[model samples]
Target: MTAFNPITISCFKAYDVRGELDVNLDNAIAYRIGRAFAQYLNDGKENPVIVVGSDIRPSSESLKQSAIDGITDAGIDVIDLGMVGTEEVYFATSHYNAIGGIEVTASHNPINYNGLKMVRENSRPISGDTGLADIRAIAERGEFVVADKGRVTLNTDKTAYIDKLMSFTDTTKFTPKKIVVNSGNGSAGPVVDELQKRLGDNIELIKVHHTPDGSFPNGIPNPMIIANQKATSDAVIAHGADFGVAFDGDFDRCFLFDEKGRFIEGSYIVGMLAEVFLKKHQGESIVYDPRVIYNTENVIAQNGGTPAISKSGHSFIKQVMRETRAIYGGEMSAHHYFRDFAYCDSGMIVWLLVIELLSVTGKTLSELVNGHINDFPSSGELNFRLGQKTASEISELLEQKYHSSNPAKNTLDGLSLDFGNWRFNLRSSNTEPLIRLNIETKGDKALLKTKTDEILAVLDECGAVSADH
Candidate 1:
């Protein structure tokens, strides 16, 4: 579609399209991506409709224009949703029966980060192993001609989406009181603020950095990072709210905290939400990432449903959710996907469900999670920035040296060693080049700690330097 050089274009990535600015990611790349998708998928129609949305990131606005140009070059009509969350982008795409869709966001990555997540017609995800590879190949080759030039127009449906969000739960359902939310100045701020305005103090609110700021002054907006969560945890304690909520850059995922300022493990949230969703939609399947508490499988089964373990990635989880028609799917990373949301992950939906559950039960977040806490003692994700490329070698060594004698081993996502009572999932970071280690024990916290220490020692001993960030 647009005439662009092949060498200068490389915004394509495994799960989506992301790269450095100018060098790898720029207007040219964005335009090429738009053109590639339009030409590859939506051709022929005078105005093949596609929904496009962008985040608050500085580089996104210009790049978004380039994408629109690309799409128009291929004779596609663009419904620009303007600045919104990635989930909203998905919602617009599916809601309007668009031929293709694109959401411009960098998510939890640093300030310099920028990227795009695209899907074919009818909200089908373009994942790495599935369709992203083909997109990448097209982007790399970068030699396509535009058959028709189309147009992009601004469309405002955020209010309609907000209405849809509130409609999920009845007004009389539950009035969760005194909950603190931290948006970290990401795109979720406005949405959360709107929810507060609409809900009108049904839940007491404590807002932290509610304004949008692409430069995450508090931190990188990732609540999983203890440092980034300091402000949120502190606010929860200061306000004595029922729970704390947080959102990353594009706000597709949400992380939580208990009343006592304790960070709630994502594993517990998955179990709680699974139970709630399954209760509403009886006998449905629930999808979950394999890196969470093993008890999640038991909880889903006990709730009169099926449990499907998926790889640790939004794209993969989404794929599995669609294939199984799972009512709910969650990742230990706080990315929650719902069948109601077209199998797309939504931080807002998960937290909304949480608020409803807490409101109806009149129980504190701590009380709700207490039942799921001791199911397993887990060493939350420990990241190591290996200066060497010996991650595979080290993983093999660990498997041969320790996991070899385990009761059973599963390498579905990475190296998952299962000893029946205690297990660990060693997985590599999808976005970053890091080997992340996770250890869990059914009834042994001491054993979990010991194993975690051993893995750290190995990382240090190997030909690499270790840094959590």
Candidate 2:
């Protein structure tokens, strides 16, 4: 008699699989995940192929190899795209007409961690409710149907993916400009180099930390961290560049800095991208998350476009984009999605579109976003680590206190209260043990500060410590 041993995998999250290496994930787990994913997505299709890729993490190569072995063992052909960004897998899945794809990357997580982002045919996201849960169940069960092993092939071509990016705008219109690009020693360097060749001599790129280093000597490539942003910001100022762009580990999110080396909040970037897209495709719907609304809402309305709101997350945004047929969708967290890009988010596309907007309009990055920033002063996202108190308890307390003010409310993704001129959104982090807060007001810098402080006081009362501290 064979014994059945049930294994528990804690890496599977609401949207993707992320875990601490050797703890929640390893080569064994990666292999099982790949086998399960192939089984779940095959759907009796013949010659089923799965595209696989990995980032620059030291552990990613072996993990990817194990995944490929498992997929091929399950009679699924594998296309190995060695050491690429997450979006590249998305591109390959749709571009090659594969059954599905997986990218072995932990993104901006700590070095001890690694994870995987997956998508089905046509690059459709496989979230928890989609196919991730089934994959998780299969992986946990550790059961597989026997079949003839398949073959593996290598595909390192980025030409098609780069071509698709260039299709977003007219390259001939790119004016001569010096730009600072910091890849944060992650997977973005190779792609940036490819872009430089296509960009020609008209645009000078001042590259910083533009190498793939697994050690992450310059820190984890997370531009959202204030400390990690200095390298990009300082390079921009030192080189006297027009603007600067920084990316995370997998390069799925790109953060921007103005000529003055001032970090531009993601919400403001969302508003600017919304306006850019609307101008090109008039009356098209633009989807945005519920984190900060006034700036994005105003921009969409003024540009003759409808604003579609969705919960904050890649899966939610992509689903909303498809349902609304939105031309572009962006989150204040620096994720930007395009309809043409198989509804997948790409940091590369975001910068390309921004550069095109800059050249065609003959406007500086600041010149374009300054008005929106002034009109809708925002508190930028604030993170708080809770102590004893739960997010719900804190939210309920805030609601009870402000209920008498008659502020309009919405619970789309979290607790959002709009008091006519001022609004705020408080939600727990989807990926971390923290709570996020964003505040915005109508053209009132002083009010923005006042309200921001007011909210901080309330959070402090709830024993929530600022993540910054």
Residue range 1-469, candidate 1, lDDT tens digits: 3445666355566678888787778887788788777777755654569999998888888989999998887777889998888888888888888888999988877777789988876577887677677666676688777555777789865887888788766656767478788888888887887787677547778889778877766667777777788888899889878888888888888899988998887887888888887787778999998786576887888889888888888778888888998988888888888787788888887777777888788888889877667667688777777766467788787787784566577777888877787777777887887777778888677887887888777777786555555
Q: RMSD of candidate 2 to the true fold?
A: 1.3
Clashing residue pairs for model 2: none
Best by lDDT: 2
For every candidate in turn, the CA RMSD to the true structure comes to 1.9, 1.3
Q: What tens-digit string does per-residue lDDT give for candidate 2 at 286-330?
A: 999999989899989899999899999999999999999999999
Q: Model 2, residue 55: what's the lDDT? A: 98
Q: What's the lDDT for residue 206 in model 1?
A: 89
Candidate 1 backbone collisions, by pair: 99-121, 178-204
User: Which candidate should be chosen as best, given TM-score against the real structure?
Assistant: 2
Candidate 1 minimal-lDDT segment of 10 residues: 1-10
**Which portions of model 1 show Cα errors greater than 4 Å?**
1-4, 43-46
Whole-model Cα lDDT of every candidate shown, in order: 0.80, 0.92
